[model samples]
Target: MLITGRTLRSLPVLAVAALLSVQLLAPYATAQETGRTVSVGTGEPGYAVNLFGPGEVTVNAGATVTFENPWFEPHTVTFYGDTEPLAPSDPTAPVPTNPGEVVEYDGTSFLNSGFLFEDPFQVTFPDEGEFPFVCIIHPGMAGTITVVAADEDVPSQAELDAEAEAIFAQALDGLKTTAGALAAQPISEQANADGTSTWSTAVVGGLFGPSDVQQFFPASIDVGVGDTVVWESTVPTPHTVTFPAGPPPFPEDMMDPLAEETFLAASGPNDAFGGSGFVHSGVIGLDWPAGQSYEVTFTAPGTYQYICLLHADQAMVGVVNVSADDDDAEAQATPTAPATPAPGPAPTGNAGLDGSGGGNMVGMLAVGALVLLTGIAAVAARRRTAR
Candidate 1:
């Protein structure tokens, strides 16, 4: 039934939820002069903070600074100095020298908070000097700590908290603007020559800055039975439109970096789905040249749920409601075109951080809620380049 001038009505678009809420760390008043704190990473749908909050901070000698991350994304606080820096043989493993331990600094020791570190990492500086650090996993995610003499004055803990709050607040503001644009995205559909229809949706679309979105634009859509839905990754980070019984529990199926062949290349059976077995799109998007989009045909009339394994913790989920075709149904609206974003050329070869290494590292480490699933031991080929 190819109705050229007829429009297919879609479900009412929901108002963007609190997808960008920022969790500000409460002021910590510990024994030794109440140290300052820095936010490692924060995220919500369509927005994320890649760089450290209050990227630069100043504290007096003997004062402690705690780095904390309460968001879904994982991060490492690695400090480099006179000591030659070394990345873990497995990028997913914590640095062997200081695996999950409080670090004391004299200004020259190489320090790392390891990958997927959940607990707040506290570091005390007994000597005063400017110390620079980087999240080895994420290229360009760097920050510095300026230490003054014990008697010199520095920004108080309250002041630093205010600064971090301002940074997060600004990110939230930007997220709202981007969400408005994304929520306005319409469901794209086209009637096939065989009378079946194809619907298109955006995966992690609408990037505003350095931040990578963790959302599915037009998260939900309506289609008739025998229709097909295609999910396209419009951003750089990898994502999967996977249909399992429901969102998988944390760490159970953490993306295995070694199995890039299976998870990155294979698009399991394309036969029409009546909602039983797993239908995985694998990892789609940047650097994955095999294909950057996936489609699945729905044969039954029912509601089906899907999620992006890479960002399930951030609630990167969507739904497709399929209804039986009715010859008497009338067209209620016109079809909308898919968004055409001109992303830059994909990286090739041993492209480090910005390329495959860093980008893929972030995707692999982005397992699920709170922290990386505890006690999942999998060795991944290490790539030390920045993201």
Candidate 2:
């Protein structure tokens, strides 16, 4: 029998005997625990796994499940069953959810773990059913949890941890290999008719299976004065190539659905960048009529750094090494192929421009090109009539 603290202190002899008896008769406790843990995000530098480790998990009713985030990127675990999510009042703020509180989720009410960071979001499942959850910020990131009767056997926490580790390890390994291959590619350059040269570099290379990499291929490039660098997106995700004085500026309406069309316009002066002030490509890969590409001509020589605002916290950065001396820059550059012109028709004013006068130049160029095309068409019509 277990004695009370007061009784044990009063009679040491009797307490010792009681404790010995209990210890000899008591069974050894096992290492297995009741609750389950899911790792939120994991990967090396410049790459991240948006997927929840062990995307599928099994648990018994009344058992607690914790979602832990240990990465810089923000993620949410939202359970939306046959209902659409309403627009968030504050784009940067997270939705409300109780941490460490046990809720008997039955798929009727929406449950959200808003902007999971260093803290773990805990919830107890009392109802036995299959529930699906997703990270709303990422398109294909999702998972499922199966709950059964309390008496049914389920995998222990150790087993679940091992499974999640193996899954992320395999996926991250494949992504590392793919990213390295992409980075090995050389920048392509073409000499234009007006004597200026154009250098082309790929943005966010491509997708690796279920993972989408957030890095600039060949993270560093060397270019000379009067050279134009064109960043072309090979992936579908929207990314911006921004050069700022301090931290990059993320627009308040970044997540607003209505700002879709206008958000892709280029910002700052695109005419020339002398390694000063702010320059941004707005949002690239937005299904614009002109294929995903942003150009900037460098006028002065200096070391410049740029980053993708969306993934900068994840170390999605690149370096542009510009040299005033054309010979030195050319010697440093590794060119594999010539870059073709930006495809599709000229972008209209509807593409939207920022207040920095960046869009004005693009609009003027578009109008001039349209007028020139119309005049050429009219002359061709007259020549055909004479024939």
The candidate scoring highest on TM-score is: 1
Off by over 4 Å in 1: 1-34, 44-47, 82-97, 106-110, 246-261, 269-271, 289-291, 326-387
Task: Report, for every candidate in turn, its global Cα lDDT versus the true structure.
Answer: 0.56, 0.59
State TM-scores per candidate.
0.70, 0.69
List the pairs of residues colliding in candidate 1: 7-333, 139-386, 139-387, 353-386
| Residues 182-258 of candidate 1: C-alpha lDDT, one tens digit per residue | 65556566778988777766555445554555666555566778888787776555667766543233222223444
Task: Count the clashes in each prediction.
Answer: 4, 0
**Model 1 error, position 207 (Å):** 3.0
Candidate 2 Cα misplacement greater than 4 A, ranges: 1-32, 84-94, 97-101, 246-265, 269-271, 286-291, 332-387
**Which pairs in model 2 have colliding backbones?**
none
